[model samples]
Target: MSASARVIRSAEFQAERAWGALPVAELDGVTVRLHWTDSPYIWHVNDGEEVFVVLDGQVCMKVREQGVEQVHWLQPGDIFHAREGCEHVAHPQGVARVLVVEREGSV
Candidate 1:
């Protein structure tokens, strides 16, 4: 759904992440979708805010710079975000589902 209206599918966004970068769901204010991957670069943020909703999986979201903020082993409905202008990476130990939201800006 829209941020203030109804849901509108974004044709510019379409991706499936198993072991790669997931595209994104339709978005006007924010984006949403499911994703799963094994990586050391899952939550890398750059000049934008990225929110991740974990559906199922073993994942770690951490700043690749500070190394202080860390989110790991998320499950269904778990949500997290990448700091703006901060780089993040997700290390998934097992397969999982994730809904990522990146607003219509630097992402």
Candidate 2:
């Protein structure tokens, strides 16, 4: 199949609910998505690597290592990378827009 490139205005993006994601593109077996949220996401470990980018607003990323949980503050333009089996979650300060790339069907 052929693919066409287009522009996406992330600042103008919105979703019906918190943590809602808009499908962006698929490369090989990886999926790119735009997520809008005002709430926190559940802790999960991706089966594959994940790239998370904050496009708007702020987010607090919580990561669990060993038995300790750490907090990371993310602002616009900040990027977070989670390797496979890494436990983490994201909590939006208010409203936020994020770009995420991960293996398709991963949790």
Top-TM-score structure, candidate number: 2
On lDDT, the candidate that comes out on top is: 2
lDDT of 2 by residue, 1-107 (tens): 33566788899989999988899999999999999999999999999999999999999999999989999999999999999989999999999999999999986
**Segments of candidate 2 deviating more than 4 angstroms:** 1-3
User: Cα lDDT of all candidates, in order?
Assistant: 0.59, 0.94
Runs in model 1 deviating more than 4 A are: 1-24, 39-43, 65-71, 104-107
Candidate 1 lDDT over residue span 68-105, tens digit each = 76545566667776667777776676565566777655
Alpha-carbon TM-score of each model against the true structure:
0.60, 0.94
Q: Per-residue lDDT for 55 in model 2?
A: 96
Q: Which 10-residue span in candidate 2 carries the lowest summed lDDT?
A: 1-10
